[model samples]
Target chain A: MQTVAHAVIAAAGLGSRLGLGRPKCLVEVAGKPILEYQFDLLAQVPDVRLVVGYMEHEVIDTAFQLRRDITIVRNPAFRTTTTQQSYWLGGLHIEEPCLYLDGDIIFERRTFQTFLSCAEANAPLIGITEAKTEQAVFVAAEPDPRTGFLAVTGFSRTDRSLWEWANIACLPAGLLKENGGDVFTRLSRHLPLRAQPVECFEVDTEADLELAKAYVTRLHGAGTQVAAA
Target chain B: MKPNTAFCFDLDGTVTRREVLPIIAAELGLAEEIGFLTQMTIKGQIPFEMSFRLRCRLLAEIDVATVAKIVEQVPVDPAIAAFLGEHREQCFLVTGNLDVWIARLAARLGCRVFSSTAVVRSDGRLGPLTSVLRKSTPIRELRGQYDRVVVIGEGQNDMPMFEEADIGVAYGGVHAPAREVIENSEYVVAKGETLCRLLLTL
Candidate 1:
């Protein structure tokens, strides 16, 4: 059983690189807003906060239309601040253990479920993947001797072969409250960090969005085949 | 040397013993629904702007006189009033509540007020909202005038002001200040007297 009761989705970015007129979360992946898929996966988590900016009204409207009870926190300075700041703003409402996911991600349901189930015991779970890309944030980690959990040591951009952060993780609320700066930076500073491998991709550029769409299409096709079988 | 300090207070919870809107709602017999919405807003489940507009619409039919009466009965922290009295020139009531509804309280407090403005129709009902005060805007303005801007607030809406101010004090007099506010604040004072004393030290 997952201990975390809250989930914080950092969706305040303008995603200027993606060149999407709206926020990245509002962009559709499989004929539906990307956030709708996120909301669907996070449905079990009782308290969910969507930190919105850059066409926030549309995001809020869409979010409410999807789930009436999901909380919305606005990072008014989203234009000037970083994703870390938006996460901090949304982090305020999170009381229990929480699963924090970046807004731009589109992943298989199994990917998140794996992270959640694996993260309940090893808190401050940093979701990492060997699937490195141009934007991959390489993490330095070592496996724990006692529990065999990967303890994160450092984060760097220079290394390409190392496991990279998937921008999805479950963290204890206490650890979150004590930290400042970017979530990745803060996690790196705090030792004994647990790492979990998950299959997820972030949609940063137009190319990334296309990749997400393709991935979602493949997922739908696979689901359809399973049903037919 | 004493720094030129300006005290910016979030009105609803930090200064008052209870939230004004829910109190007014209770008086108007819409407490259950309004109170739920208020809780939702405070919990960050709903955007403050959306919740504020919905609450205002719910209270639209309510006469100004009745609101005034309810406002009169609303309990403000005595310690806050005392603190403001000692430093009236440097203190300001910065609230998202309407100027018209809070005018009497502002006058009674005798401090400069920065609040949302509302238009009143000829029949005395609130018309369309003219301006919804974003707490950070005034805090930013105050930063230009004061050497040190100290913001004291308890809600999610107050987080912006806290971000803008030089010193953010999360007061938990009515209830525990929201976690985000507390995390961002320089000082966390749970009691009204302690909050007043903390202000003096700063």
Candidate 2:
């Protein structure tokens, strides 16, 4: 399987709805901060650029503690701009194909492994899951007639039948460079989007955090049971 | 001077609250040496052209990618954004820093930049300095076009510009303007907001 060596994590949002008084990535989940798990999984990726705002100093401190060579980009106008802008800013330093992850996401390492191991190495791949939530980015997909692989038709905010976007994707450097004001919207139209099934969720509110914790705990318990059996 | 004046700003201390070269040097673990050289140059103990070339030579082996990442994090004065927004076309970033290092920053500010140029090697590392900027050149160039050229700076490097400009403001927002810069200027402003108000009256 082909492996990418760069990743861009957009963690610049204020996370006001999370009500954490700090950036959501710093919020502890299970035993460690949410971004810690992400760093552990992405340790092999040599270049990791973290776009930070809101509590930038704290985030940079945490990120440096996790990895000494991590590159940090600050979006000073983060209060006025969207996550897309932060993504663009962080992507500036990355020159190779990269995995783009949202800061508020919590998922098993296998989810990323699955996406990386998938056969769609050349094209952009967006992770999608059967799991649904009130605040999920819905992705429309159809089975490819030739290869039986699921091909992404479009993305929407209010599509009930569509699977939820898992907030993780492997994007080509060219696509990242071409990103403008509305990145995701433009990307869906420009790239030949492929879908990878992964078990993942985004954390936005207190209830979402609880959901993430419970999901992780359940996965851990299931692993323990299998080990004992 | 009327509203049709050209505004030239010194990048390191005047426009940005921090000295960019020392920050870059500190990131590369050469802060003490570079910092001393920078202070000596600014204090007029060493000539700028000589200090600048020596600094670039020390930075020659550093990868352009690493420098770009570090430069991206260098903080700019917050009030300068609004000030530039109000007078976009007239604002110019005049810095002695290499073009290879400050390109992204200048592009982000969306202003014309008069900066030193560095030779980028085939391997993507910074090479020798091709051009050393003299601030007076840009100030004199602006004078030909505008009725009044208002220059704001805080370093001895800006002394030539202060002599060439029609109106000079010694800015001490980050630290006190150098003695020679302060002596040559007509007004001195220490705060960003106050500087903006002073510019309005110009």
Each candidate's fnat, listed in order, reads 0.00, 0.00
Per-candidate TM equals 0.54, 0.54
Steric clash pairs (candidate 1): none
On TM-score, the candidate that comes out on top is 1
What C-alpha RMSD separates each model from the true structure? 12.3, 16.0
Q: What TM-score does chain B get in every candidate?
A: 0.95, 0.95
Off by over 4 Å in 1: A174-180, A224-229, B1-202
Q: Which residue pairs in candidate 2 have backbone atoms (N, alpha carbon, C) closer than 3 angstroms, thus clashing?
A: none
lDDT of 2 by residue, A132-176 (tens): 666776777878876556877877777765587777778776565
- Writing each residue's lDDT as its tens digit, candidate 2 over B13-66 gives 888889899999999999988988988886778888999999988888899878
Please report the candidate that would top DockQ against the real structure.
1
